[model samples]
Target chain A: MLVIARHTLRETVRKRLLLAVVVLTALFLLLYGVGSELLARQIRERMLTNVDTALPLAASMLTLMGFYITSFLGALLAIFVSMGSVAAELETGTILTLAARPIRRWEIVLGKWLGLATLIAVYLIVASLGILALTRWATQYTPPSPVPATALLILEALVILSLGMLGSALFSTLTSGAVVFMLHATGWIGGLVEALGSVFDSQAMVTAGILSSMLVPSDALWKGASFYLQPVTVILAQNASPLANPFVSATPIATSMLLYSGLYLVACLLLTVRRFAHQDL
Target chain B: MTVAIETVDLCKQYGRRLAVDRVSLQVESGEVFGFLGANGAGKTTFVKMLLGLVHPTSGVAHLLGRPIQDPRSRLPVGYQPEQFRLPEWMTGTETLELYGQLSGASRQDLRVEIPRALERVGLGGRGNEGVRAYSKGMQQRLALAQALIARPKLVLLDEPTSALDPVGRRDIRDLIRALRDERVTVFLNSHLLAEVELVCDRVAILHEGSVVREGRLQDLLKTSTQLRVVVDAVTPAVVEAVRPFAHAVVPNGRSLDIELLSPDHVPAVTRALHDAGAQIWEVRPQQMSLEDVFIGIVRPRENG
Candidate 1:
């Protein structure tokens, strides 16, 4: 099993797609750091003109910028890392040789998930560190704490990766990636829709938005991460409750999604094993 | 002698088509059993079923006297599939070592045997080279080496010589024959009649998912009493004179083609042809080649 896992990790890590992700992430980080450094230097210089006004607002905006940047990059990495887990193997018949071996099907699935999770973990650490490093270097700004934010980002990535892998099992690679992307996109859309409905007092629209969030809770998790990472005073002043509006706040993902992911992995593995066990060579 | 592999009423179906009908066969230890058939004749399907690469619809297969599905049974069988696809980026050595390890070869054992296995298959120092760089024949040799390296009790080869050149064919045949000397059962499928006729101790001809004829090579070719005689001259008198000893003797200007009743009549027919002022050039008994037998039996059934 370790042999299988090691080989899978090595083979996938060598993929040009993953390499491209690494290159893009590195370039983005360099740009973000350099750009933010310039912006902060200008803000600091402007602070000499208006000492009280510029600094605090700039610090707050900097924190928000870090959150937005990290969240988007995390989501992209999670989706890209797992989109091809099953579908690519099925397409290339690479899985056939391994599945035909004495190893159980679920072991193959678990190994793949573990390998992808490790990849996601690496990207999360690098990107979060990039954000933290940029903020410190640019503005002498250090947010209260980044550990919670980084943890939340990692959790979000894990959830997305699991969903993407499940989608891969059910649909072709392209379809699965598209579905995961759409779910992530619409989950954010639903949050916006719910905010509009509440402000305008549209009961029917509010309910519709809430139901959409329940259907795919990716945005709910992201919103929860937002709550976890934000200073407590901000939430109290805004009267924002993660649970009061499931569409906008990241509530703890239901126990069912976790259970569903476990089941999904097992089912995908069994289907692969049974189908490939007797596959005509 | 113990049978290395045995199948009882093995049957397989794909949708409405019976790919391999009820077939039973036994390949004993130290015998090279040729599975002869045209394309689509269940040779591949049968080999798959035997190797546990595919499930038989209804049958029992025993490898090394244990049930085929039993984990223990599979340990003693090494298989090289007909249309095998290996990882393109893997070096030939890596591919062999991986499979060798999977087949339960110890690292210590692999160290001593890996290079020799490569050399035997003509990929000796090329193990580190990626499979994509290898030609079709070289890839095939590497595949064969992987199959044989484990030195399993039985090697299930499908179309083992199909794409090989004459030299490669001879090498493979020799390797297969060598396996028998090691007391390994060689169960191979091939369309090459001469290959089977030369190396097989016994062969079964499959047609339309059924075994049409099967026996030892000597037994399959043993039944012939016809004598073909070539002479310097052939005339009506020579045909008429030889007619008494042959079922029919037609004069073809230079030779008298005689289909005789028995081998005893060959000498008399030759003497009669010679006595009729015909100079005898050559006289020999007609023996059936595998091709002749295959065409003779399969064509009529196909036509009908």
Candidate 2:
């Protein structure tokens, strides 16, 4: 299993997708960070009056942008990296040589998942730290605790990788990628429904949205990250602040969702191993 | 004559199609057994079932006296599948090491065997080259090297030399033969009649998923009935004299072509030919080549 993991990690590191994701995310942070800082400076000078909320507002706003961008890009990277873990190996016939050996199929699946998870964790840690450095250097603003948010972001990336790996096991790459993308998109949109339900006293809509979040749990994790990154002042803001919108705050994920994701991945791994074991090459 | 591998009414199905139809075979230890069939004749499907890659529809297979259902049974078995694909990103050395570990080769064993195994496959110093850079033959050699890494007691090779050059083929054949000296059983699946004829002690020919014919190579070929008669003078009396022993006779100055019912009939025909005034030069028997037997069994298309 170690050998398999070692080889898999080597191959994955050689893939351009990892470097591409890092470069794109850094470019995004640079542009978004510089532009937002310049705009905040302009507003402060134009008013000819110092606003207490200016720095906090800009810091929260910039963190929110970084969070959103990382969440979306992290999910994208996870999906792209993991979508072909099983199906591509089977299709390309590489698994034939491996399967013909005495190694078990479950070991292979788990090994691949481990390698991909490691890659995702490294990306999240490095990129999140880079974003934090940018926030400090450019705006001289720091959120309450960046470490917790980074940890949550790592978990989020893992969940997404699990989803994509599950899809890869159940279907071909094309179909798997499409289905996972839809699940992600729906999860994001459902976050809105859950938020609106609390404002309008719509229990049915809230139930539907909560159920959707339970189905994927990705949106719930993002909302949790938002709550962590946003300040208490913005949470109570009346003008529907972008950083801590009340609608986004309403649906805090239940503990059960994390268990579901874990169980979901375990089930996916079991099914994949079973299917792959008997699969004729 | 202990059987190293055995299948008891082994069957496999792909959806509605019967890929392997109630096949049973026994391969003795220290023997090279050839599995012959046309394309899509269930050769590969049967091999897959034996390797437990594909679950059998019904029945069971035993490798090295243990049921294939037992994962441990694979430890003593080695396989080179026809459609074998190596991971392109892996170097040849890394690939062999992986299989060696999976096969439970000891560090001491690997230290001595890895390099020698590569050399046996003509991949001596190219171990660091990625599989993608290797030619088809090199990839096949690497596959063969991996399959034989552990000195498995039984080796199942499917077209083991398909992509190899003549020298490479000879090297593999020699390696296979060497395995036999160590009491290893070799189950070879190939359409290469010449290779099978040269190596296989016993062979089973499959046609449309069923074993149509099987036996020792010599016994199968010996079953083909033909007469070879050499006479100093080929005359009408000699032909007429030999007429009762044959279905038809064609006189060719020094040779008399005779139809034979069985190989045993040759002695009687020779006696009858000697009874006549003609001088009998020599009496011989005709044996079918593996190619002849192959073509005879696999019914060719009308146009073909």
Candidate 1: pairs in clash = A223-A250, A224-A250
Q: Every model's DockQ, to 2 decimals? A: 0.23, 0.58
Shift in Å, residue A161, candidate 2? 2.3
In candidate 2, list every pair of residues with a backbone clash.
Answer: none
Cα lDDT of model 1 by residue, A78-193, tens digit: 77766777777777655534443434445566677777777777777887788777767776666555776566677667777777777777678889899989987776788678
Candidate 2 chain A TM-score vs. reference chain A: 0.90
Candidate 1 iRMS, in Å? 3.4
* Reference-based TM-score, model 2: 0.89
Candidate 1 chain B worst ten-residue window by lDDT: B68-77
> Which numbered prediction scores highest in DockQ against the true structure?
2
